[model samples]
Target: MDSPVQIPFKSFIQLDSKSATAIYLQIVFEFIKAIQLGFLPEGTKLPGSRILCRLLGVNRNTLIKAFDDLESQGFIKISASKGTFILSSQKQVVKKEGIRSLPNDLPVAVDFDFKKSNILDNPVEGSDLSLQFNDGLPDARLVHTDVLARLYVSKLKRNRNNGVWEQLQTQAHLNFKAQFCNYLNLTRGLKIAPLNLLTTTNHEISLFLVLKLLINAGDKVVVASPGYYFSNMSILDSGAQIISVTIDEEGINVINLREICKAHQIKVLYLTSVNLYPTTISLSAKRRIEILELAREYRFIIIEDDYDFEFHFDNNTVLPLAAIDTYKNVVYIGSFAKSLPAGFSYGFVSAPPDFIAELEKHQRILASGVDVIKEQVLTEWIEEGEVHRLAKKNKKIYKERRDYFVELLHLKLEGSIKFQVPNQGLAVWIEWLPSFSLIKFQKKCLDNGLFLPKTTLYQNKNLIATRLGFGSLNEKEMENAVAILQKSIAEVLIEIR
Candidate 1:
């Protein structure tokens, strides 16, 4: 029999006085764990209670109690003349062959297998660099966080007495849904009621819920080439095969869509119609009507993601397709993330009431419920017209930034790039002329302390372009970023030569 000192009881057996479990019970659990793990062989003799109590920094009474419990549990055998010895159980072996010390840390990797998907990988990159460009995000600096906090606090104080269950039962968010419906109706020309709207934490979740309801595995879904990557990921994750169509300056080619519809049974058509992603071009009204007509004829559903509806810089901004969706063929998704501050942002789907009811069921499973306090605050924000006021303010500021950014691009990169002044949205799509390597350019820019996220870079056989967001950068930052871009392009071009 091995001596008790041969085993490292002090290393594995630890007691936490702060825990609700008694010290005696803790000791028993540790001893059983060590024995089952083969660290303590069946014939190993344990130290006396007086010695173990000092080693474990516990009272003699606690150590005695632990020993009694372990013996009663059949984990240990005590004799009058012999010391206590570990006993083998049917559940575990007591032989120390190929055994190592008991694990003192949590597992680093899962022991079981699960379905792994490369399709669901996140494309967005993070950077600690001060100068960075995103693919058309609202300026975080413009968000009135102080005002939002005040509103949140005020709502909390007023509802201090209301229990969470009671608040949920009352359905206080109904008022917010009603206000959001009215806001959408007035701004986007959508006639919807609270029952027709369902809100989620953000735009992606809203889209996911809608697709979960409508799409089945192996179904054919149509999207534009060089379209929103995140939405494409969601569609593929739902087991739907994606079919790509072309996008021109006027927007998605309805003629091409018509041909595809003839060839395939398309289930859903997804597009950001207000401002086509990566390229800030609005789908023309003529094409909108044609697409709606096609949807009616083909019996396909159109998902119009009017993500930046409130930030149109040009007077020719077209109303969303849902406005003229006479056949109930359009499911519209919109987000306050584009207009409001980050934390205060929310996304909602506006569709037929029955469709929304089904979507609410899906949301209940996925997200459980909306944040009560946030819903109330946003409800008051909309009802009190703060949402509108902020939208107007942001539009003016972003428009000026856009113009200034355009001017800088023309001045710094006159012959090297080609672009059109964006009519709507917060980004400008610039095609790189003379086609030097964009990957090299991205690297050079990074070395110079300017971060251009991979999500903003678009490359193909015929085109090399990037969607440069101007909304988040002020004039000084824009100028600095443009300078870095210019220098990087020059360096990359020289290397190619």
Candidate 2:
């Protein structure tokens, strides 16, 4: 097909061999000029590379190279099925006078309206139950904004007005990191240096930065099957091959991963070893040790997502593999986003000194570095005993909520719903099978103002289970939610029968 977004070659195929400019580059500039002139709109797809090569009467290699150069510069995008299309541009493209108007045969209008990739508009925003189950980040209502206000005020008053930029190695920043280390040592028993922890804006940024250092594009990484669906998206975005190891009731099937390791050279073994998603089972301690041993023998790294280590509402607290990774093979990841607060915007990566150095380099390259003062505030929270105090306070409140939710279920719908009381977690995993799909149950529950995420949100669409986040719902709300859920489940079962 001809280019929908076309640039009539204003200049002949002039091979300027004597000049420094390559012939392909000469053609590239002319094409760019057309795009700047409004000849190409947003939806307009460029001709096939072969067609472009033929029309320009240039070598196919040179044409393809020019196309690649344009793509890398963000002037155009190469879609999977739609071919190349004009990307958002800032400068204008000027066209020559007396050019014929756009052909009547062309359908797509070339508009340079740039926008970010589509974002999922969550219906949970501003929901009445929003405070209860919107576990994506720290609720603005919950964070102590006054603390942040003071910190930023200090920067303006002390640092900027004096013409002294805040030193990255200031005493405040260092103290914060040290306190973070102390929290880890106390909770997980891993005595990390404050310098070893690199606080990130969030988990997604943290994972992306770590993966860049540890994984080359197209390298093989292993993850638990039906795992955090988002992890698979992240891995694939990094251009890495994902090997899905089956997860059973005991968490990741370590035995199967080992067999895959024998068959293929794996780069990273990613697991949410702490209260893994969809199914709230942490890896057995024996398998945790076995996984690290395998890492040492196989020369790969273990990406441990201790995402919710603090909320384990159980006395027999499960240990994270990072706590016992004496060999430095485990890259420990912790996030306070789901644990205590959000907008503190902190998650950490704890690894060996070498990986830590490489991670800093990667941060510089990736621009996902932590804010110095935010780190300080968190460290102060730890030192001032706010974290532990908050944890202890929330524990009583959340545990009561969990117990109330469970008790209410027993009273309202005992035989129909089955779930486990997790050792320590805000959410409980439930399995229901008088043959009712969770989505069907969710739809029924939504009518009564009780909103919960179905298991399909975390795993494959076919998997039928539900995750009830009790941490966000209070005692009165818990009983109310339970009553609504009981009716919801009954409605689902009635349809199934």
Candidate 3:
């Protein structure tokens, strides 16, 4: 057996007086780490308490406490005469030649094999540039932060006064569910009880739960050609094979979809019907009726992701398919974050009561339950009409931004790009007419201090387009970004020539 003095205890057993962890616990942890890493193998005898205390420059009492803890935890055996011996069963084997020094950090790679998922890789990109564009995200600055802060604090105080915080796990916050259901009924034309709705932290989780419940491995799922990338990832990650259908001005090609239905058994058809992602076009009323009829005939679920339903600027806005889904085949997914500020968003699913009950089971496994305090805050926000008030206020601001952005695009790149002024959402889909590379344009934009995320760029053999979000950019920022975009296009065209 190697003597404790042969092992470099002073090197591996590091301690910090300023650390918040207790000194004795720190010593105990260091010893456990050393043993596990083979620095101190099983049967290695440790120095006496007094000797170690002197060597490590630690207090005698602290060293003794560490030894006591190690022995209690079965990592060491303390004897009256022989000395403390390492007793850890998990200790790695060490050579008898000498003690080798290793890095203090833990191993980075695991020794065992496990499954890896490339389908779940994140497609979202982030940037720290002062000027940037996204795929139609809400403006964080326009959110009512002060009002939300006050409401949250007041609710917390009231909960504390009534001793409700202690019972948070049990409190269901049914009032919020009732108010949410009522809000949907009035705004989106859905008649649902509190039990028919299920709330989640965000749209992705809500859709994930619904897909996991309905889809199985090798199941066939249909999505639009240039669909929402994140939702498509989720569908593929659930082990379902994705089938793409073309989308046009009217929305998804229902005629083509019916042909596909005739050929294969599709388990689900996921779409952003209200304002189609990237395109910002609504599924026409005629197409909505036809799609619903096909769903009834073929017995497939329609996941209508009406993510930005409240941000529609058009006067002739159409209601969601769920509003007129008499066959109960439409599973509607929506988010409240588009109306609120950055962190205060919540997502929900509207389905049958029985389906919701089944979803709750999966939700409990994923997240124990929704935050009771947040639910209460939203309940008060909805009941006092603050939610609607904010939605109305922000809609006016976003519409103005959209108009200004469209004007700038026309003024700067009239012949170089072609686009439609989207009437429903915060983004405008601009198709670039030039044959220059979109990737080269993105690189040039970055060099000029403007970041255009890869997710916002859509390119194929037939099309070169980008979804430029104006909601988050004010007039001055929009002007600057557009100038940079125009300059980058000119530079790319020069390179191509």
Each prediction's TM-score versus the true structure: 0.77, 0.69, 0.77
Query: lDDT of each prediction vs. the true structure?
Result: 0.80, 0.66, 0.81
Q: List the residue pairs that clash in candidate 1.
A: none
Better of 1 and 2 by lDDT: 1
lDDT of 2 by residue, 1-497 (tens): 35442555433233333222356555555455456445565556777878777777778887776776566545678887878888754222111111123443555554678642211112222324432353322223445567667865665455444443455436666677677777778888887896678767777778878877777888999988656655665776677777878777778898898899999999999888878875678888878888889999999889988777767677888888888888888888877635444566577888877777777777777664446556665665777887777777667766776787678767887776577777767777666645544434554666566655422333222344566676666677667777887777777778768
Error of 2 at 124 (Å): 8.4
Give the lDDT of residue 69 in candidate 3: 58
Could you give candidate 3's per-residue lDDT for residues 1-497 as a string of tens digits? 34666666776676655332357656775786677556686778888888888888899988887787576556788889888888744322211112122444657468899985544544555555778898888888777788888988887777766655546635546777888899999889899998899988888889999999999999999988777868877888899988878888898999899999999999999989989987888899999999999999999999999988888786776799999999999999998756576456888999999999999999999887567777788888788888888888888999999989999999999899998888788899999998755656776787787888757877665678888988889999999999999999999899778
Q: Supply every candidate's count of residue pairs whose N, Cα or C atoms clash at under 3 angstroms.
A: 0, 9, 0
At residue 314, candidate 2 shows an lDDT of 70
User: What lDDT tens digits, residue by residue, belong to model 1 across residues 250-330?
Assistant: 999999999999999999999898889868888888998999999989999999898877788766657899988889999
Off by over 4 Å in 2: 1-163, 337-341, 365-370, 453-463
- Indicate the TM-score of model 3: 0.77
Pairs clashing within candidate 3: none
